[model samples]
Target: MKPKCGIVYNGHLQSDKFMVQLHWLSDTAKRHGFEPELIGNHRLIPAVIDGRCTLLGPYADYRPDFFFFWDKDIRLARHLEKMGFRLFNSASSIEICDDKSRTYEVLAEHGVTMPKTVTGPLLYEGFELEDVSSVPSIVAELGLPLVLKEAYGSFGEQVYLIASEEELIGRLKSLGAKPYVLQELVASSYGRDVRINVVGGEAAAAMLRRSETDFRANVTAGGRMFPYEPTDEEKAFAVRCAELVGADFAGVDLLFGPDGEPVLCEINSNAHFKNIFDCTGVDLAEAMFRYIRSVLYAADGSRKGDAPC
Candidate 1:
């Protein structure tokens, strides 16, 4: 019998690309000799009952050998781990990648080449900074114009360009204690960046994103995409980032430095692959399914003989 993979995804996410990717993932699992089931996050309610932990709700009688976690429900992911189920892009890695501050904190210690950054203070109801209006040391270090990104946001909606001290204060006041980061704007990569999809510790595919009217070059934000060929240095850097994050597969964004060197932007644990597939004609889903199969079998062979996941 083939192993079962519960592809857990967010049902509330309503998007064409989201649905398409899920379909592709399911199809690829079948092609790779696995039984795939689409399990929404709502179905897997983590709970403890009768002195034991278990998944309840509409999960039915379907038990998975391992899970392909596509949702960002960290608690549920951890619960699944407690049950000894193997998950691609493990829960801790997802948590770090989900929050910008955590991602920077983990990578910064390793001397990754990224923008100069400062994580925002903890949020409280009446918290206020003393010198946001004076270009204080924080602003002084990051400069007059910098990038203020909310720690938790996607699709470039919460990222802002603070061009003046007043704008910084006003934006902070509006933010009202939400966690954020202050980063020195890498002017050289304005409205442009590269997205490299790394699978099984290799750069599988890449694309260049550019925008004519917006500083943020996200495809959902109206950016144009073109096939990109990363240099050997760029490919190696991206693979290193994915390994550092402990992701089986990930999308690594790179910003161009002043001298055109690649700078680490951020890592996406659950990066949307449809855009990359469309631009590069490379199917990350296929690569990912195949890669995980090998990993699961290799472990089984080395440990308990003939076991399957």
Candidate 2:
């Protein structure tokens, strides 16, 4: 009997992009001899963790052979993990990678090159911006054209490039005390960066992102994709980032620092692959499915209840 697999996503199936990826994942699972099912918000998703009315609905009250949280968010993954679901990428990894500042900290701790970062408290909590007296020193250290980002933001939504002190203060005031991070801007990567998809601690594919009009290079924000070949150093860094966060699959973004070294910018636990797939013929969904299946098979054989072959 084929193992039952659930592909979960937070968006509605009506979304074209989401549907495409879901189909790809389902197809890959079926090809690998698994009973793959696409479970979205409108339908019931088995093996889900209870108490969350997410796009995948509530848990089906029974354990599945395999549960894929897809891009449904880290919180759901954490809840499911607590409910005894075998997740491909654990909730801890998702949570760490989802926050840019945390991702930076993890990479830096592992000796990976990354921009200097300082996280601030939330604006709504009455955290005074005046408390950050070292702003000037930080600017002096990192120089002009620094990047400011919210703690939890995606798709280039909450990123800013402040070139002057006035601009920095104005932007901070506008943020209204929301938690944020300041980092040295990699001017060379102005609207450009490399995104590498790693599976099982190996670089599966890479693509260069370029946005001529915006400082953010997210494809969803009008960035163009170009095929990129990862250098030995880049490959090593990608692997390290994935392993550091304990991600079974990940998208590692790398930018060039002022010293011309490849530095980790961020890692995505549930990275979208259509852009990279369009640029490079790497089918990430298929690769991920194969890796997950291999792991499940190995784990099954290791269980005490399993018969010795």
Candidate 3:
């Protein structure tokens, strides 16, 4: 019998932008000889019941050999892991990638090269920042035209450029107790960066993202895409970042340093690959499937012939 693969996705985020990838994943799983089941995040309930942890919901009875967790619902992802289900891009990796601040700290601890960053404090109590004393020191360190990013965000929507102290304060005031990070701006990579998709510890595909009108080079923000050939340094750097985060598959964004070196931006555990596919004509879902199959084989060595891919 073929191994059952659960393709878990967020139910709330149902727009085409989100749904398109799920379809691709599901289709690829079938072609790769697995029984693919699309499970909604809401439908798979993990809870505490009868003095023991329980998975209770409409789809509670259904269990897959493994899960492709495709959402940032950290709580749910962790619960699935606790229930003894193996997750691609493990729960811890997803949590780290979901929060940019955590991503930086983990990478930096291992001496990975990236921008100079200062992570802001967490204010979980109220909606007001009681003190503004640290603002000056942050400004002094990063200087004007620094990058301010909310710790937890995606698609460059929560990232901003502070060109002045006033603008910086304005942005922080609006943030109001949310966790954030301030980093030195790589002027050389102002409106351009490279998105490298890594699968199974290898650089699968890459593209250059450039924006003439915005500092963030995300396609959602009107950036143009062009095929990019990564240097050995970039390929190794990106692969290292993905490995450090424990992601089975990931998209690593790299900024161009002054000397054409690669600087880390952030890593995405469940990176949206439709954009990369459109840009590079590489189907990441297929790559991911192959990797997962190999992973299952490496785990037990008994599934080598189970519905062979």
Candidate 4:
């Protein structure tokens, strides 16, 4: 019997890029002899909770063998995992990766080399100088032209380069101090970084994201993507970062520190693959399916072995 796969994606198929990813996954599944079902955003929650059922829009309900969370939204993963769905990159991993502050903590715990960073409440909400005093210390230790970021931001949004103390304080006050992270900026980056895609504990592909005009190097932020091959040390660092967070698959961003060492920047659980696929010709969705199949098959075999025969 062909295994049924359910892919949970934002229902807005209006974007040509999103539609292309969906088509690629569907085609790959068909080629692999699996029944492919695309579950839009509306029906995703109920379908996962109901188990082995299908849902039509907001009404129908269905369960699937495996659930693929395609969006950066972390809440979906949390809800589905609670309902006992087999999910890639698990909910806890998603939550940790989604919050920049938490990501730093986890990476640090694993003894990964990363930029000197300070994470706390948003600037607008008002942080006590005493409570967040370490932020200034990091600045003084690492030197000026630092990066200030929101705890939950994507596509290079809400990230700022602070060149002076006034600019740093002003930006913090403007943001209302909700929750943010301040880090030592890597000036040599020239608004560029390496994004490595890892699956099943291996590095699939890597690309250099460069934006000479802006401080952010996200492709959507007017950056360019070029093929990149990480050195052995770089590759090992990327893989270890992903493993530290327990992600089934991940996109690890790395930057060069002052000492010219590869430092962890951030990790994305539900990484965008359109740009990566365009640059590397690696069909991640297909690779993901194959990996999932292997895991499920192994588990089934283990169950049979344990059964009283």
lDDT of 3 by residue, 1-309 (tens): 877998888888889878888988999999877899998888888897777666886876777888888888899888878778888978999999999989998887786888889998877757676677888888898888899999988888889989988788888888987899999999999999999999999999999999999999998888999999999999999999999998988999999999999999999888898888888899899999989888787555466554223
**What tens-digit string does per-residue lDDT give for candidate 1 at 206-308?**
9999999988889989899999999999999999999888899999999999998999988999999998888989999999997888777764534234444
Q: For every model in order, what is the number of clashing pairs?
A: 0, 4, 0, 18
Cα RMSD of all models vs. native, in order, equals 2.4, 4.1, 2.7, 4.4
Off by over 4 Å in 3: 298-301, 304-309
The candidate scoring highest on lDDT is 3
Residues 128-164 of candidate 4 have per-residue lDDT tens digits of 4434355566668767888898998877888888898
- Every candidate's lDDT: 0.87, 0.78, 0.88, 0.77
lDDT of 2 by residue, 83-193 (tens): 566777788888888888777777665677877787765556664566546678778887788999887877778988888977888788777757788988888778889
Candidate 3, pairs of clashing residues? none
lDDT of candidate 1 at residue 11, scale 0 to 100: 78
- Every model's TM-score: 0.93, 0.86, 0.95, 0.84
Task: Write the number of the candidate with greater lDDT, choosing between 2 and 3.
Answer: 3
By lDDT rank, best first, the candidates go 3, 1, 2, 4
Q: Which one wins by lDDT: 2 or 4?
A: 2
The number of clashing residue pairs in model 1 is 0
